[model samples]
Target chain A: MILVIGGAASGKLDYVKSLGYSDSSISDGFIGEEPVVYNLQALVAKDPEKAPGYYDELVGKEIVICDEVGSGIIPATREMRDAREATGRLCNRLAISADSVIRLVSGIPVKIK
Target chain B: MDFLLTGGAACGKSTYAEKLVLGFPKPRFYVAAMRPYGEESFIRIKRHRKMRAEKGFETIEKQTDVDEIELPPHSTVLLECICNLVDNVMFDDQGNMYDVTDRIISEVLTLKSRAENLIVVTNDVGSEYSDYSAGVKAYVQAIGDINIALAQSFENVYELVCGIPVVLKGELR
Candidate 1:
């Protein structure tokens, strides 16, 4: 029930490790079990349609990491736009349900919840 | 009272502002400050309108000259953003940068005085370290300047990070 989010390579993993999550417990996406730290962005990118279900399962247990990909200039291509929208929607859902939300900026963790 | 909401792009400032406005007394107005001059802007404006379509907000599209908008006294008003208002006043109308910040301050003060609750939404445009065009840089500076002024003037100022509100000034309530 923790959401760790930031821009690409903003040290999301380092912070997750700081929390003592084992590497083996982490995952790129869900596979019927909650990873110690799940990369929510990768799962959304792999199949945007599965994001809602992943979120449903990960809502109250998994520690999720998602990249902040919706900021800056809006995308011109429909595909990129869809990806951005999907990421934003999923993050918003997690933000609401997660007990804690942390935003990493330059390896610094700023607690938002 | 005035409430200022600021955050990076797509960081849920608008949605947060919407929720704030909803908590106040009605005759709620959403003051949109973007001109649909190009394809991208047109798409953005349409999307914004659709987002607030069900929020019981009577949309007022005014890119600049916010002081010109007519509102009933004691109504809650949400100025969608200050960044776009500065952009419209500067690049869109070729307004001088030196005076743009002052003008926005005056307009915002005027708007604030006219409402029971004024929630101003703005972006944290200068936080990014990327280089931008001269015009874009000027716009960023203008927004930063106005945001500082707003932070001082408003009783409540908040910055959203990943959809969580951080109070910079007054209490959230």
Candidate 2:
């Protein structure tokens, strides 16, 4: 899966849509429950050996879009830190599996694998 | 938190995203959702990649199910274009439209919750003319709902008009 990162108004969504994707396929925050979120965390909590099924379940999905939280300094609250840590781990894992990666700025796309 | 960028077509969303990514101190991943199914698509993808040279991005072409992929931590993820990805997946097989929509939404939310810095690119389809095919209408409605959900979930949301960003939430400057 691929992840997208950019600042506000950077055209990240437009670029994805231009590639023929609808809004549903790009954002990670849908109206209802999402399977990947639960599965990934479960796997991390239980370890790969205990959650082999979860590990096998997430192979070869296309272009997973994630919002970037690294643009500024770290959060002060513990809950925020935990959220950031989870997000950081998730992005790192997806990046390694992704065939390529892209970054955007001022509505322009930059390819970084 | 998630970052969402929405705007009209040809409003320079891609260009803006490239600049932001370039500003990062470390290298990041650039995910291009365009498949280039025809000559026109291929040319367009080529042009986009070429224009992004200044940002030093590596391009990955994705054309598969998005639900089964895994992401790494601490890395920047850029997804260029959400509309096309939905179109490709929704019609991939002779599947029911509702099923496709459900899967798409689920996958997107999953990605957002799991990724580090997820940058999303999508167009503002709600403001366009309403006269369209039945299928097109359904797609637009579905996408509108999805966009609203994304905006609500993300900490940062921006609307681009005439190549300029009008921040709707969070601190962007």
Candidate 3:
């Protein structure tokens, strides 16, 4: 699996597409059931009970993309804060197993793994 | 070695900080500044941090007056998230507001001098441009100024991207 993470407008999707994965192959992590998963952050935020290990199913099989959270002012609400912190913790296991890890900064793809 | 680690929320600053400290000798100290307020939030955040909880280290809570913290010589220290410390010191026990930049910087420096490796994890809250109130604006500015000053003092500085350390000042060990 390939893990792609960056802030908003970092061109994560474009970088993934540049790797030859079609839009059809990519799935919305919140709704779609496709092979490549995007928005893993939202999916985890939607369900606070789900752990990072929950994504173990995608190991070596899906392309994951998410927006980096938790860097700014702590959220005003409790729910939002929990979701923000959960995004990083829940993805730890998947990050370790990812075949390739990419971070998009200013629309430029920087390979971390 | 002193490190100033800056990264977006949940970009794995604590995880990376732990990795850096684990490389050093024993007697690791985790200086956390988060003050528990919301029960639900605490439980949820606790669940998230469980991964790092059991790691070999001693936990210390230094919400304010960090200069008062004392540690054994040659120990490694990881102070997770300065945003909380700034908030704590700014709003005292009576919830009064004041400028805490210089006090925080000086106190943190004092704390750094006591450790062999001081890995300070801080947030990057200056990116979003919003019409925040005077108090919010002041808080954000204080954090930014502290980050800039600390980055200059720390030997190694990094901004984590997706949990990966991106060198901003010195080379990774």
Candidate 4:
């Protein structure tokens, strides 16, 4: 699977569209049969440990966009910390197995892998 | 020469910066900007030492006022995590509440002049949507502005993600 990761509002959606992913091919995470999933943090936050299995169920032929929530200061609440930690772990896993990994910074996409 | 290495928390920027320093000459200096103030910081400082253990780095703890620091000639220096230093300087016990970006940058340039290569590690902490306090917002603005200014000064800039380096301003050496 291709992983497009960036911070919130960093234009992951636009980059995916630039890659020729049409609107019909994009879904919000585990809701549609679309090949591209955006805002994947919502899914991973549910169960970060199981996120790898969930992504694997996509058959490794999909494109996923995950917002990076791990670069800022330590969160105030335990729940927020858990969520960010989960996102970090899941993103690392996806990056390792991704066919290509791209990080978007203010709308510019940098190929990382 | 100056290089700025940036990334989010646990993104391997420190490890990569260490590798870059290793590629430079001896008398490598690691100017740790994080102060050993609280429990969390103490743990972090120890962990950082463990990360750079046996790596031949003469670590110097300069939690604030880096502009006054002087370094040996022909040495490679790494200033790890500049955001902490900004906090120590801006939000001190005296609470002067002044923007110290220009002074900090000038001091950093002074240190740069003393070293052969200065590699700095900063954070990408400007995208959160939640409303923070006036001080937190000001701190964020300060660091964000400082990153932009430093990027202009540094010859090479890199951002790390998932232990991988993405060239930002210049080609990786």
Best by DockQ: 3
List where candidate 4 sits over 4 angstroms from the true fold. Answer: A9-40, A43-64, A71-74, A89-97, A104-110, B37-39, B94-96
Candidate 1 — which residues are off by over 4 angstroms? A7-10, A29-34, A37-39, A42-54, A57-61, A69-85, A105-108, B37-47, B50-56, B93-99
Tell me the tens digit of each residue's lDDT in model 3 across B1-173.
98998987767777788888888888988877888776864774585368457777788877778789888888898887788899787876776789889999998899898888898988899876468878888999999999999998989999876677889899987
Please provide, for model 4 over B44-131, each residue's C-alpha lDDT reduced to its tens digit, 9 standing for 90 to 100: 6887799789989999888877767777778899998778778777876776687888877887777777889999999988756768
Per-residue error at B22 for model 3, in Å? Answer: 2.5
Worst 10 residues of 2 chain A by lDDT: A30-39
CAPRI-style grade of the A/B interface in model 1: acceptable
Evaluated at residue A1, the lDDT of candidate 2 is 50
* Shift in Å, residue A30, candidate 1: 8.1
How accurate locally is residue A71 in candidate 1, as Cα lDDT from 0 to 100?
A: 54
DockQ by candidate, in order: 0.37, 0.02, 0.53, 0.39
Q: Which ten residues in a row have the lowest lDDT in candidate 2 chain B?
A: B60-69
lDDT of 1 by residue, B1-173 (tens): 78898876557787788889889877899988876666656866787778788778888878889998888877999997887787676753454545489999999999998989999998776654466778667666777889999889999999876677889889986
Task: List TM-scores of chain B, every candidate.
Answer: 0.90, 0.86, 0.92, 0.94
| Model 3 lDDT per residue over A1-113, tens place | 88888777889999888889888988776535677788877788787667455566667456888877766677777678778877876555667788878888899988887
* lDDT of candidate 3 at residue B25, scale 0 to 100: 83
- Give a tens-digit lDDT track for model 2, residues A1-113: 55554544567777777777775553243212222221233233333233333223343555544444322233445455445445444555555566665556777886655
Candidate 3 segments whose C-alpha is farther than 4 A from its true place: A29-33, A51-53, B40-56, B93-95
Q: What is the Cα-based lDDT of residue A85 in candidate 1?
A: 63
Model 3 per-residue lDDT at A42: 75
